[model samples]
Target: MHLSNQGLLVILVVGVVAGWLAGRVMAGGGFGLIGDLLVGLVGAFIGDWLMPQLGIHLGVGIVALIINAFIGAVVLLLILRLIGGGFGGRRRWI
Candidate 1:
């Protein structure tokens, strides 16, 4: 199925918001705009899967989607930090 432009825009907004929120929750986790977008997009997938498995359901709609993605992004960021993941030689976000 083809996605409408509005749908794509909505997704982007959700991703950015979710990623930003996750970053706020996890200090030094924000990977900037593009990186946050990617993290958010991937996090959305992880959240969609992990939440259900954990018996954590946030209901439906955009707000729920954002919450789900934020939770997932926080997890992703936590893992990255655990693995010593950083951009270039920068360990702390500036």
Candidate 2:
């Protein structure tokens, strides 16, 4: 479904916040506003693609989207860490 401009804007804002929160919770890092938003938007697509491949389906809704955002943020943080871009400190998760 195509989103109106306002809808898209709302989604972007939500995605940014969700992404930042997810990153904080999962990686203990601050990605700033723009970075969070970009990560969220990209994460949405990646989550949608990966979930099904992993035999998990959340259907579609706000909740599903939020789950997607969280997954995406986690994935992005992992990638960032792998590339030596994560916050410098002890690794929290192994």
Candidate 3:
């Protein structure tokens, strides 16, 4: 569904908060505002895409959004680590 500007803003706020929470939980540390928001937004999309492929279906709503955000944040963190060449001495993805 298409979101109006206000609706999109609200969604973005929620996504950002969700992402921050997820990042804190996964990383055991704080991810500042912008970082959390970006991760959350990306996480939302990643979670939505990856879950279906993994046979995990979450109904749409706050819970699903949060789940998606968390998954996305985790994946983002992993990617960031790999990109920074900090994957514990493992080969980088790129």
Best by TM-score: 1
Worst 10 residues of 2 by lDDT: 85-94
lDDT of 3 at 88: 38
Alpha-carbon runs more than 4 Å astray in model 3? 86-94
What C-alpha lDDT, on a 0 to 100 scale, does residue 86 get in candidate 2? 63
Write candidate 1's Cα lDDT for 14-63 as tens digits: 89998888877776557789888988988999999999999999998999
Instruction: Please give, for residues 14-68, the per-residue lDDT of candidate 2 as tens digits.
Output: 6887688777786477677887888788877778788889999887777778887
For all predictions, the C-alpha RMSD in Å is 3.4, 3.7, 5.1
Stretches of candidate 1 exceeding 4 Å from the true structure: 85-94
Ranking of models by lDDT? 1, 2, 3
lDDT of 1: 0.86
lDDT at 15, model 2: 82
**What stretches of model 2 exceed 4 Å from their correct place?**
88-94
Query: How much lDDT does each candidate structure score?
Result: 0.86, 0.77, 0.75
